[model samples]
Target: MRSLMLASLLTLSAAPALALAQPGKDCHLPGTEESLRCLRLAVPLDHHAPGAALSLHVTVAPALRESARRDPLFLLAGGPGEAGSDLVPLLNTTFRKVRATRDIVLIDQRGTGLSGKLDCKPGKNAETATEDELLAETRACIKGLNKRFNLYTTEQAARDIEVVRAALGYGRINVWGGSYGSRLAQAYSRLYPGSVRSLVLDGVAAPDQVVPAGAHDAQAALDALLKQCADDTVCAAAFPALRSEFDALAARLAKSPQSLTLPDPRTAETTKVEMTSMRFIGTVHNILYSQADSRRLPFLIHSAYQDRWQPFIARSNVSRDFSSEGGPAMPLHLAVVCAEDFPRLTPELLAEDTKGSFLGAPQIMRIGKMCETMSVPAVPYKEPAVIEAPVLLMSGALDPVTPPRRAEAARKYMKNAQHLIVKNGGHIVSPLGCMPRLLRTFLDQPGAPLKAECLNEIPAPTFQLNSAGPQP
Candidate 1:
């Protein structure tokens, strides 16, 4: 599910065999909540050639309570770009219930943080790169990345995982993935099926699915959000004119894609930019990560429709304090989306795809089109992980990135899998609300599994946008 074949083809420029190599045999996990450990385990940068030599990053934590511990839980982060090794504090808290029963592990995939990151610089801004600029930047980045690191795909990352498993002396490990993290979980299960005892995919992304699937799933999530809005008396009353208002906003933005200017939330710079349909979609898409975030959408749409640029401005503004030259990173994204999702898009499907989208698919397609120049063969990997070994699939009903449908589809592939869908939940639902305790119950007695009734008790999302009146 990655983007740059050109980037994958270039030879390393005298780079060491292991750029971020740290042998994990002696790796330590934190004893205190505040102290977390990260170490590099040498994995072949190219798994196809493991004996060729490369290094991978893996961080392990010994269980909080030694007696109740079962096996280590491998946490895979989404984005194929975002790294998970640094999220120990958050992960520990979210999975505390499970931690009491098992260790939580985080693996930062290649081309992401701390694992021989493919980026040239960290903390770069996205404000400067237009779609066109990003396309060019990606080509250059792929060339540069190929020279510095051998661009192995997710399949390679999975095999490297087994090495960590063997070195750690743990025969079995559990998996939990969110957003693009789901891709990692699927690949891991495919490559090292015997190594995994259980898998928990939050925001389940099916291995067979791609960008169009993602786009279609997000549209469904939006529909769910709209229904939630209707169910919320406060939200419905507050923005009864929501749908019509949304149409106006899109029509206006389409007429004048680049006329809008708002102070950048991160820098407060008054910058002129295109507020095209795709940007509109991009701006509000990730909010589906949680039910709490969904509650604020009505107000967001109403405000944007009403020419209240503040909502979009505040939401669209981003920072890169710890990101890897993160701007559009469009080039990498284009390569990935184009090959796996948009490449086979039919003309009619392409046209219909954007019909309902507030933003036309053309904008996303623009990136996909540009990516054709650097097309590479899709990485060879397994389908979604649905084996029957104590598997649990958790998804947010409103999760745009990986919707409930993905989980439902996974059920067919898995012999012994069961899914829990949080009605108002967005992306990662396991570590929050009632999920932790329910998960605790499941792991405490794997054979005597608790019915996922707690998920049923979870409340629906509150869809009231945070649109405030003047100084009220």
Candidate 2:
């Protein structure tokens, strides 16, 4: 689910067929009412390839009922590594109101899904691998994929969307992007202003703002945990020195890491997770994505300090699993972020984002290092052509990444926008709270008046930090 909709289509061709009586490939998608169909217009691997053409699959689940169809809403999936077309099941309910008016469109991105995915799993999953086995694995994966793979850049993807827009014959469409998809939405708005009518960016990672780096975001979970403890009579009285306790836990692990043997999902074998400050920080980092898990951060650390390893072990791996489908998504992620976000990083620029952010820096640095070797021709970061469009930006106050401050920072660039700060809501808010209803209303009006009260429906913060578990 690397958020690669054009991963399949764009890598192949750019020559539109003008209407080739439907190509032969079957575009089957379950749980929808329409038949899936596909056709490829050969696109060059290098845009320089003038005549070479490749066909990519483009499938759609037309509006279930003609009575309830509105202009389509294009779903832009997250995961600088997730597949846009593969998110249908995850979104049907959240967008039900909007769906009553239009079809939900899904497109497999270039070099993703069936469009020639960049998945490399056999190496990491094998039972025979030793402690030092990844180098060969990485080598094999690289050589194997150098074959038919083409541009994995967002610029290539933008062009692919133009082809799909023309083929489908839609003059304007509503776009909804979550997390990294939000980045794509911004890019699209800049590149193809005429194509987008309305936009919904959840977990807003705006184009102008620098993505935060370090453990400061994770530190927010610890802060959330402290507040939760203080609010609860039992917790406040029981763990009064929560901050000291957490700091001590980190110090202890940094000095003496526990060798933990846990069940491995890859092969159902026992694997060792040696505790470290970085691992601990990363564990806290995962819970920041959702509110439910962030609550568990306190309990996880509290348990870890008492020498009960289970809780900490569990929380450690959540972000990794959330980021991947138990496979190799890191490389493609590098291709995108290395190109779009942090390329040509100045030391001062990196420091600016990391300042006071405990959890943000590590993640940002991790991305930066990974991106160093895989840099592509950079695309110019452009501002949205029209800030006139009513935009709704959502953020969780306690969210580790894309926190309220980050959301507010993005708001400054918008000429007209509503900034909804959910007291304790985590990263993803579109599918929850008053967001669904507000979104429905927004789309219903098209380019109409304002409605600020709907945001009132969001539940107030009753902050809690439960123990998060090891990630996948």
Candidate 3:
């Protein structure tokens, strides 16, 4: 009886033939099978104003076998600004077993990817910009955007997912969302629970988690890196006063910005770049995303303190994202962050959250203020999603961004779920050792115990004692 009801819900009164978007030979990831289909969906930019529409980019990689399951799996990307379809190659590779039976779907959300991407270029001298100067740039960004910025909220994105699901004629979907994508997955489940068959949240971000509060998590990750260096005999011996050295370097940079010719890692051409406290912190935050990257921190910090700028600059350049159009759309990031998280962050909240943290709250608080100034409406806060569908929650034990606590908090609301913590992992937990098999097992049999003991085999990143990195 339940199955029949679900089928009825999935097969909603069909959309008009004229409204149905068509699939054609479009985007494909490198090494993806030529058989994959690409689609361009036209969803409303503002649901209230049906006349205003936006074109969203989507790609579907069908099941490998002829006898495939009817239900498909939708993969959501992180970064409120991240292109959802970017995960296609990774999904195609990592979830190959699941793809043998289930089609994998990817939808670039309304404001990201080819879906009317909202790229904004802030002033070039952002590292030295005053609060007023930054605000002026933000206003200029708002003036430059062509679309209705207000409609790009998370709730609206959730609605867009439903439209895509209905357009493609999927009766049910299993969702896997990482980082910020996890939050969107929950929103979709809350709004359309019946459409979801199962849920997997990697780097789970609970609904109540204000975006700026993540500063604390980043600080903690840096602290963990410091502590690890302290505990490692080789590392401690190499840099006995690591923390003090870092403090001195930060203080020095804060007082006087250093300008150097940075050798482009890709091209040997030297480029002049300025290093300030803000720039250093920003670079550090990006590096902390992966344990492999964090392994370079101790060495990089020691080098920086000694005024050896080449290695530090080269390492910093590794995280740079260059695009034909500025970068991943910042307007989309602003739209989502302002509407969802920024409104809740008060001055008191900032003080309380950032206290004792090495990374100060200035950058995030400034963003929060930007959102406030732009007058982005707040989506009513809700309790964590109470999902009836079986869920798999994953987190990296060492993740500085979305820590294990987030998964633990989200686990409470899921009726049937399992939480897995990768001991040596960073922000992304699923891609680590033995985790792919565990994910496959969960998809094959939701609520079943995973044979994931192999996760223990993965070890912490070997600390680099010198320029040679970890010796074989």
Quantify all predictions' global Cα lDDT against the true fold: 0.61, 0.60, 0.76
Model 1: residue 373 alpha-carbon error in angstroms = 5.4
Error of 3 at 216 (Å): 2.2
Candidate 2 deviant stretches above 4 angstroms: 1-57, 68-70, 122-144, 147-150, 212-218, 237-239, 255-257, 261-271, 317-328, 355-357, 360-363, 380-388, 412-415, 449-472
Candidate 1 lDDT over 1-472, as tens digits, reads 0101111232333122333333334343333344444555565656554455555666666466747454777888766566666556555567777766566767766655566555634314445445555456555656665532224455566676676655445567777777667766766777678877777777777766655534566667777777767776777888888777767776776776655677766667887755665566666666655667666777878877767776766665543111234322333344455555555566776676566665456554655545555566654434454565666788877777677887777667777676788775777787667888777665655546557766777766445546553111
lDDT of candidate 1 at residue 90, scale 0 to 100: 59
Position 58, candidate 2: lDDT: 57
- Full ranking by lDDT: 3, 1, 2
For model 1, the superposed segments whose C-alpha errors exceed 4 Å read 1-33, 68-70, 120-125, 147-150, 261-270, 319-355, 380-386, 461-472
**Can you give the lDDT of residue 366 in candidate 3?**
58
Window of ten residues with lowest summed lDDT in model 3: 1-10
RMSD of each: 7.0, 5.5, 4.2
TM-score per prediction, in order, is 0.82, 0.80, 0.89
Identify the runs in model 3 with alpha carbons over 4 angstroms from their true place.
1-19, 30-35, 121-139, 259-272, 318-327, 372-374
